[model samples]
Every structure is written in C-alpha cells, then in structure tokens.
Target: MIIDFFSAGFDVFSSPLALILTFTGIIVGLVVGAMPGLGPLMGIILLLPVAIGLPAVAAMGFLIAIFVGGSCGGSISAILLRIPGTPLAAATLYDGYPLAQKGRASDAIGIAITSSAIGGLIGGIVLVFALPS
Candidate 1:
C-alpha cells in the first residue's frame, strides 16, 4: 500500500510540469533564503499556511523543503552576517564566521551553495529509487 502510494506519488512527480514546479520552488526558496531579513525560519514559517492547505504527500514534501531551503539559507546569515539562522548551521559558523570576518564570505557562501546542490542531487537520486516506476 505504501509502495503503491509511493508509485502513484512518483508518477505524478515525474511529469515535466511537476518537475518544473519543484525546481521553481527550490529556486524561490533559495532566493527567499538569500535575503537579509528573510532567513530560513522566517521563510518556512511564512509558507506554513500554504503547506497546511496542501494534500498529505504535498504537505510532507513542502515540509521536507523547509529543511532543504534552510540548509542554504541558514548558512547565508552565517556567511554574510556572522550569525547562524538555524542551530544546524552552528557548525557552518565555525569556519564561515571567520571566513566572512576575513573577507572570504563569498567563498564560504560558494561552498555552502555547492554543498546544497550536491545534497539536492543525492536526494533526487534517492527519490528516483525510492519510488517504483
């Protein structure tokens, strides 16, 4: 039954339009994360209303997205303002804060961006395997 759900879910997700929407969402999330006042927490919090209106699987995906976007957004403040937006980014601050203080904020941000992309790639692969085609 779960497998059936996953399969049905994956089938819906496999469409070009669905993929486009997902990618658009990721880009929008990252943009939201990049802003100074719009940190990851705020971004996710703001989206909560929309999440609640979604279906079960969509709501789950949207919530999963909060973390993914947060991973990128949390590091932004650490790299730009030397403040951690999320606790998970406390580790990011160890080197990122110093890097920013030393005028290496861009480098730190670049690394954070790359790590986020790699993670997304791995997640995409896992998602592909997790759902029966």
Candidate 2:
C-alpha cells in the first residue's frame, strides 16, 4: 500500500519532460535565490506562470527542485558578499564570510552548497523512511 504509493510517485520521473523541467528549475532557483530578499517561495511564485502550462508531474518536479536549489542558493550570497540572500542562510554568513575573506570564496561556496545538498538528502531520506512508519 505505502510502497505502491511511493513507487507511483517515483514513476513520475520516468518522463524526460519531468527531468528537464526539474533541472531547469534548479538553475532558475539558484539564480533567483542568490538575489537578496528572494527566497524559494518567491522563486516558485515568480515561476508559477511558466509552470502553468507544464504537465502536473513536471510542474511539481520543477517547483520542488526550485525549492531545494533555492534553499542552497542563499549560501552563495552569504559566501560571496557576506550578506545572506535569505534568512535561511544566516548561519552560512558567519563561516562563509571568513572563508571568502581568506581568498577561498570558491571553496566556501562549494562547501556551503555541498553541505546543503547532503543535508537535504538526509532530510528527505528521514522523511520518506523514518517518518512514514
């Protein structure tokens, strides 16, 4: 029962359209999220018009990807400018700024992004496996 639901949800990715949209959404999210004051929600809202024409699965995939990417994107600004792109990146600003000042801006950004990705992966796993049962 639960397994079937999970499988059905994963099945949406079988479509190439969903993959492409998701990828594009991530890029768009990264760009939008790097801008100060524009977080994941705003990125989704701004892009909703475009998503309107997409199929349901693709739209959801795109929006979800945007959210994930946006959440990580704020770290870019935090690392580069010492200013958090969003409140979610506030913690990043502390360590990220120091690294940036040390001529390791690239390294700081990489670490921030990688850590965010890993955190998201772990959170997703916990939600899917631990929380369900």
Candidate 3:
C-alpha cells in the first residue's frame, strides 16, 4: 500500500504539465503573498478557477505549490522591508529585520527558504507515514 502511494505520487509529479503549472503557481503565489493584505488562502482562491480547469492531479500539484510558495513568500517582505506581508510572517520580522539591518537580507531569505523546504519535507513525510496508521 505504501509502495502504491509512492508510485501514484511519482506518476502525478512526472507529468510535464503538472510540473510547469506547479512552478507557475509557485511564482504567482510568491508575488501575491509578498504583497500586504494577501496570503495563501487568497492566492489559492484567486487561482481556483484556473485549477478547476486542470486535471485532478495537476490541479492538486499546482495548488499545493502555491500554498507552499505563499507560506514562504511573506517572509521575503518581512525580511526586506520590516513589514509583514502576511499575518503569518509577523513573527519573522524580529529576526528578519535585524538581519536586513545588518545587510544580511539575502542570508535571511536563504535561511527562510531552506527552513521552509525542510519543514515542508518533514511535514509531507509525517503525513504520508501517519496516514496509514
């Protein structure tokens, strides 16, 4: 059963269209999320109509990418401008602002991206393994 799940996931991700849409969604989400008053929910909602026209697997991939991108995007503004782009990024302003003041904005952004990726990976793994138990 676990193997089947992995196989299905791989198959879905192997689609070129899915990959392209996911990347585009991520870019769009990042842009939207970096703007104040916008967040992942809004980003996803805005793209919902486009997703509705896509295949199930591709749509899921695209939406998930948007969600992940948006979650991280807010930190960009928080770090660079000392303004929280989203409510979720408010906490980041503490360290992010300090880092930016020190001329380490790039470092802060890198750290944010890396941490987000790691956290997402762990979450995905946990969800996958926990689902069967």
Candidate 4:
C-alpha cells in the first residue's frame, strides 16, 4: 500500500485538474477562514454542494485543502485584530498579536502558515494510516 501510494501520488499530482482543485480549495479555504466563527467545519459544510456535484476524490481533496489552509489563515485575524477567528486560533493571539504589535506581522504570519502546513501534513499521514485499521 505504501508503495502504491508513492506511485499513485506521482501520477495524481501530475494531473492539472487535481492541481486546480487543490489550489482552488486552498484559496476558498483561506477566504472562508478569515471570517470569525467560520471554521473549517463550517467551510466544509458550506461547500458540500460542490461535493455533491463532483467526484468523491476531488471533493475530499478540496475539503482537506480547505481544512489545511483555513486553519492557517485563521491566524491572520488573531495577529492583526487580536481576535480569535476560530477556536483553534485562540492560542495564536497570544504570540501572534505580540509579533504584530512589534511590526513583525508578516513574519509571524509566515511562521504560522509554515507551521500549519507541517502540522496538517502530520495529521494527514496519521489519518491515512488510521483509516483502514
């Protein structure tokens, strides 16, 4: 299965539509996430209509993409406005707002985004292995 995954991933990633869906999902996620109280669950639920009309794989990719980007994007409000955009982002305000106040908002945001991506990757890996077992 692991070997199959690497091979399949290479091919799947080469497809333009997959890339588009992923990109679109990330953008949609970031936009939706910026709204306070509209977390990944809400974003996914709101976009469920798209899933209904699309292939299951594409829909799931989009939903996960949103979850990844949305979680990261929520930090923007936490830093810039000192408001916890989502429950998960409440912790971000502690250091995020301080960095913003120090005029390092961009750096803080960059770190937050990078960290979120790493965290998401870990979560995905764990989810993948856990799903079938």
Q: What Cα-based lDDT does every candidate model obtain?
A: 0.71, 0.90, 0.89, 0.83
Output the lDDT of residue 17, model 2: 98
* Model 3 C-alpha lDDT per residue in residues 1-133, reported as the tens digit of each score: 7798689889878899999998988898788878888988899998999999999989998998888889889999999998888887899999988999999999998998899889999998888778854
* lDDT tens digits by residue: candidate 1, 1-133: 6679778878866766445545655665666665655656676688778777766556556656655776677778877776676665667888888898888888998999898789889998888679875
Clashes of each: 0, 0, 0, 0
Q: What is the lDDT of residue 90 in candidate 3?
A: 91
In lDDT terms, which candidate is top?
Answer: 2
- How does each model score on TM-score? 0.62, 0.92, 0.94, 0.85
Model 2 C-alpha lDDT per residue in residues 1-133, reported as the tens digit of each score = 8789889988867799999999999998898889999999999999999999999999999999999889889989988998898889999999999999999999999998889889888998888787644
Clashing pairs in 4: none
Which is better, 2 or 3, measured by TM-score?
3
| Candidate 1 ranges with C-alpha deviation above 4 Å | 1-10, 31-45, 52-60, 120-133
Top candidate on TM-score is 3
